[model samples]
Target: MKPRLPQLDRPVRMPSRSRILAAVIMLAVILGPFVGHLLGAGHGQAATPVEPLPLDSLLRQAEDQSPQVLRQLLLALVMSLCCTAIHLAVTVLVVVSYESHSLMAWASRTPLGRITLIAGTAMVTFLAMFVEILSWAALYLQQGAILPVEEALYFSSVTFASLGYGDITLDLPFRLLASLEALVGILMAGWSTALLVAVIQKCLALRFHRTDHGSDPTTATNP
Candidate 1:
């Protein structure tokens, strides 16, 4: 005869810290461009038919415009903070719902279910990054830095990926904003990678736990 382990009435909880950080990075990636747009709006239009300058010249130009650069940086910081806070709230709610439902445990019970869960998580994170890129694209269109929405989005995607294809280019002022967008993209992408890894690891741990207990005769009993 074997003793049965007690059934857990309470569901296991996912760690919230990593998810919260991922959400914050996602939000910052979107709002950083918006902040740049708002702050630079009053600065007037960037010179069209932009003259290509050497890297040193561009760096010098940015350095000379200390006040404007400072304002843009301040605005970006404020927006990032606000967006990060909002993301944290949303993440908390989502995590609470997921934990209460015992979704992870159910997913762990089956190989197909685990795969689906991991795939879904990856998709969600990818979508978040895509949406953030779209926001920057929209801002580019509004600011006249890019022509059509399609082109703007294409450029945004390229910049977000840090591909720097160099086909489409922005003027000096907006170039700074573009650079900022690229930075946000890098951070968000890294965060998403971390999130996906965490999710997969958690799922695998659950699966292994189930396997261990199922294999143990002491943990099971005849009805």
Candidate 2:
């Protein structure tokens, strides 16, 4: 038989001012894309024709014409990143306010719930980064030829990490976007690691307490 959990020990959280603030910000980020898409659709009706995106068209543009394709691509990427950052910022604010043992409490309530929640958060971040990468690749390919899918993923990751090995050079504006993504990745990664460690420590402390009490229930009661 599966063992029953000891009762959860953390104090309750209530609806409060900070939660409302976070809710509104998160709602805005979650809603922003659809709103932007709607606006884009409306604007596209009146806008001039955009450049084509096939391999031939891109190469033709990149080799002889201006870097407009690359610039446009990077604009989409920047938008994707800004949205991702806002979403993550919302997550951070909401997460930081959570009381001790909360994720563990949720985990205790249901198998894989916490895992799924974390996975969803990761997916959102990666998808946003993917949009950024695609923007760069879209511009690059328009300028030149299509990169192999594997090559594109590799290039995107390396560029985002700012470890540009000089193997995949880009037009000037795209080069700037690569630099910005790299800087963002480094700073955000450090911040994420720190926050993750703090959260894990809090969870681990609760687990340690549970273990101590398991050794003797009265030990917890006495302490």
Candidate 3:
């Protein structure tokens, strides 16, 4: 009984090494685009500046030849991959930690702690996705094609979620990149939700055990 109870009451071990690795991965992902852009900009191809496309035309072009237009597309792809990797790593962290925390709290634990952590992590992930979307919108807008912040955000959310409402259709070339964002977003959201639920259930079970489970079933039994 003592051993089992103590085991259940132990705190989860944080993976310091994994977290450090995650940080490195995240940094690399973030830098991939800028690095790609620099490298792509200086490639051996002979370059001749040409008349810039008109706003609408450029926007269309950017949308269509996204790969050709921004050297960052490749970088963005790599960045997205990094984000995915970090996302997965963080997820594993939360799961392992939550389990450990639950085991430690044992009979006295409640779902509140786990809930808070899950919610916090999810919120951060949500923000990260939005930020990535905003970066793309800003890049395009810099090229003279403008979408309202609200509209861009909406499209971004939908894209990230992979809902593909089709209400605000991006140009053909842009669509491919957008799809990638959507896929990443969907996977991240799903993973976050699963971890959150698991933590919540564990927390709730502890609460139940301490409350209902500890109660005398016959306390209210008629004498």
Candidate 4:
């Protein structure tokens, strides 16, 4: 036989965290103005040009707002990080519980059991998300950014879901915070969807593996 070339078996490496963050920031900077223009266009309003401020006035305004801007950024970061941690903790607990019990493992083999598992997981995740939304609403209420408890919760729910009904709007000070909430919501929603897909995929894989070997699913170790 002729000499055979060796196959490359190396796994692909993922981008580093710093690179990913840089890319995101770069994309946002490039796209931000275009998105703002589109949003303004949707409002059917004409842009009005104002006289430019002097350098000293601009610097003074920036200095005055910097503290508030930093505070809002910190708040957004903390809230998003907390929500991420909560989601991860819940996911780990669920996977551990499913793997630890033989009954759960065996049940995952059947259609009905798998349906139940998915539904339970959905409900638990929903509750977690609801709590997160409530926390944000409480913040808005405490800040008096939105009046009436009901309205605050409504705005929080809509923003967190990225629905953006636009019927209700936060005051100028909190508008940036709301935008941050929308971003966090999008990320959390994607993460939850991924978790559901992973659970379904794992269940299907386990079912097929057990069916092929004709072995007890309970005795099969989890990946």
| Candidate 1 lDDT, 174-219, residue by residue in tens | 7777887777777777767876787787667667767877542213
Kindly list the per-residue Cα lDDT of model 3 for residues 87-187, writing each as its tens digit: 66776766565445333353244455546655766676566656656665664455333357777767766777778788887764465567667776777
* Model 2, runs deviating above 4 Å: 1-103, 106-150, 213-223
Regarding TM-score, does 2 or 4 come out ahead? 4
TM-score of each: 0.61, 0.43, 0.47, 0.73
Q: What is every candidate's alpha-carbon RMSD to the true fold? A: 25.6, 23.6, 23.2, 16.1
Which pairs clash (backbone N, Cα, C closer than 3 Å) in model 2? 58-142, 62-143
Query: Largest lDDT belongs to which candidate?
Result: 4
Mind giving the per-residue lDDT tens digits that candidate 4 earns over 4-96?
988779977989999999999999999999999999896665465567899999999999999999989998998898889888887997788
Candidate 2 lDDT over 177-202, as tens digits, reads 55655676666555555555554554
How many backbone clashes are present in model 3?
5
Candidate with the larger TM-score of 2 and 3: 3
Cα shift from native, residue 150, model 3 (Å): 3.4
Q: Which ten residues in a row have the lowest lDDT in candidate 1?
A: 214-223
- Go through the candidates in order and give each one's C-alpha lDDT: 0.71, 0.59, 0.63, 0.84
- Which candidate has the top score in TM-score? 4
Clashes of 2: 2
Order the candidates by lDDT, highest first: 4, 1, 3, 2
Residue 114 CA error for candidate 1 (Å)?
Answer: 1.0
Worst 10 residues of 2 by lDDT: 214-223
Ten-residue segment with the worst summed lDDT in candidate 4?
A: 42-51
